[model samples]
Target: MKRFFSLPNEIFSLGLSPGALALYSYLLYCEDRKTYQCYPSYASIGKSVCMSVNTVRKYVAELEGRGLIITEPTSVITRDGRKHNGTLRYTILPIRNAVDRYNQRRLRQLEETVERMRIRKKLEGNEEHPA
Candidate 1:
C-alpha cells in the first residue's frame, strides 16, 4: 500500500475532530488514484491505525454528518485483484468556507464512479471472480 496523505491542517478549520480528520484522510488515501493512492481496508485501517471498528465507525459517522465527506457502502474491486474489497464511495466535500476552493472535478469523479460501478456489476455476470 502507498503512504497515507494528510488532509492539511486547514481541514481542522472545518470544525472536524482530529479522529474525523484522520479518518477523512484515510478515506482519501484509499480512494485517491493519484499520488500514494493505495490504502487499507476498514479492518486493516482499524488495525493499522490502532482504532477499533466501532471507534472508526463513530468518527466516520461524525465526518459524514459534518459534510466533510460523503459515503455509500459498497463493494469495490481490490487493486491487487486478490478479493473484492468493500469500500465506501466517499467524496470529500471541500469546505467552501475554508481553505481551498470547491473541487468540482473530483465531485464529478464520484458521480462517474457511481455510474461506472453500476455498469461494472452488470458486466460481471454476477460472478465473484475471486475479487
Candidate 2:
C-alpha cells in the first residue's frame, strides 16, 4: 500500500525557502486526513527530510511565521509521576488561508510601490516646472 498526499500549487507561490517547503510537505504527509494534525518529534521529521533537528526547528518556525501551520507544545507523564515535554503537535492550516494572506501582503506591497512611483513622478514634474 502506498501513502500519498496532495500539495497545493499555492504553496509554491508562497515564497517559502526550500527547507521550509520540504518541512511543510513532510508535515502534510504525516497529518491525519480528518484531523489535519500530526505529532512528530523533531528527530523524526529531520530524519524523513534529511535535515538536522535544528534545521527542522528552523523550518517549523518559518512555516508558523507564514501562517501555514500552528504548533502546540505537548507533555507526557512518566511512570515516576513526573511530567515531561513531549513531541510538538502540529496542526495544518488551510492552504487557502495562507494563499489569501500571501496575496494580501503582495497587494499591499504593490500598492505601496505604485504610490511611491506616483509621488516620484509628481516631484519630478514639479522640479521640471520649477513650481
Candidate 3:
C-alpha cells in the first residue's frame, strides 16, 4: 500500500516500488526468516514460497532488471517430475547495495511508466503494484 512503500522511502532515503521491494523482502525473508542464503532456483523458490512459478519468474526478472538480484538459468528439474541436470541461479544483491540500486532502478522504470508523474507521485498514487 501507499503506506508501505512510503515507509521505505522515509527509512532508506531512496525509493522502492512495492514490486521491487516485495522481491527484495522475499529474498530477505528467505534469509532472515528461513535462513536460505544460498541462491534459489526460480522453480524451487516458487514452490517453497507458495507463489506460482510464473509469479516467481516474473518477480525475479523484475529484480534482475532492477539490479536487485542477479539471475541465471540452468536446466533444473523439468515439469514432468524428472530431476533435470541444472537450475536457475538467483543472487540477491547485498541488502545495503540492493537498497539503493533497487530503489534507483525501480524509480527510473517507474518514472518511465508513470506518464507525466514524478516517480514518488506515481508510487504514492498507487498502492497495489505487486512483486
Candidate 4:
C-alpha cells in the first residue's frame, strides 16, 4: 500500500466535521488508482478509523454532502432472488476543484464586504476617492 499524500489544507477550509475528515482521509489512503476512486466496505473503513460502522456511514454521507466524495451504492440479486448490498464506489473530488471553489467563495465575500464599506462611508458623508 502506498501513502501518496497528506490531507490538504483546503479540506479543513471546507468546514467538514472531524468524522467526515477522518473518513475522507481513509478513503484517500485506500484509493487504488490515479483517479482517486475506491471501493471499500463500511466495516473496513470503520475499523481503520476506529469508528462504528454506523458512524462511518454517517460521516461518509457528510463527506458526500460537502462535495468531497461521490458515492455510488450498488446492489446485486442472487439466483435465489436474494438481494445483496454491493460495495460502495467512492470518487474523491479533485483538490484543484475544491480550492477553486473556496477561492471563488472568498472573492464573493470580499466583494460583499467592500460594497458594505462603501455604503457605510457614503452614509457617513465621506467623499469617495477615485481609484
Candidate 2 Cα outliers beyond 4 Å, as residue runs = none
Q: List the residue pairs that clash in candidate 3.
A: 76-86, 76-87
Better of 2 and 4 by lDDT: 2
Better of 2 and 3 by lDDT: 2
Candidate 3 lDDT over 39-73, as tens digits, reads: 66667666666777788778777767655567656
Most accurate candidate by lDDT: 2
The top-ranked prediction according to TM-score is 2
RMSD of each: 18.5, 1.1, 13.7, 4.9
Say which prediction, candidate 1 or candidate 4, comes out ahead on lDDT.
Answer: 4
The lowest-lDDT stretch of 10 consecutive residues in candidate 4 is 122-131
| TM agreement with the true structure for every prediction | 0.51, 0.94, 0.45, 0.69
Better of 3 and 4 by TM-score: 4
What is the Å distance of residue 111 in model 2 from its true position? 0.2
Candidates in order have lDDT scores of 0.66, 0.96, 0.60, 0.84
lDDT of 1 by residue, 20-80 (tens): 7777777766766553233355677687567898888898788766666666666667677
lDDT score, candidate 2, position 101? 92
Off by over 4 Å in 1: 1-6, 33-40, 76-85, 97-131
Q: Tens-digit lDDT track for model 4 on 4-98?
A: 76777778778678888888888888886687789889999999999999999899888776667888988889999999999899999887776
Candidate 4 lDDT at 62 equals: 83
Residue 62, model 1: Cα distance from true site in angstroms: 0.7
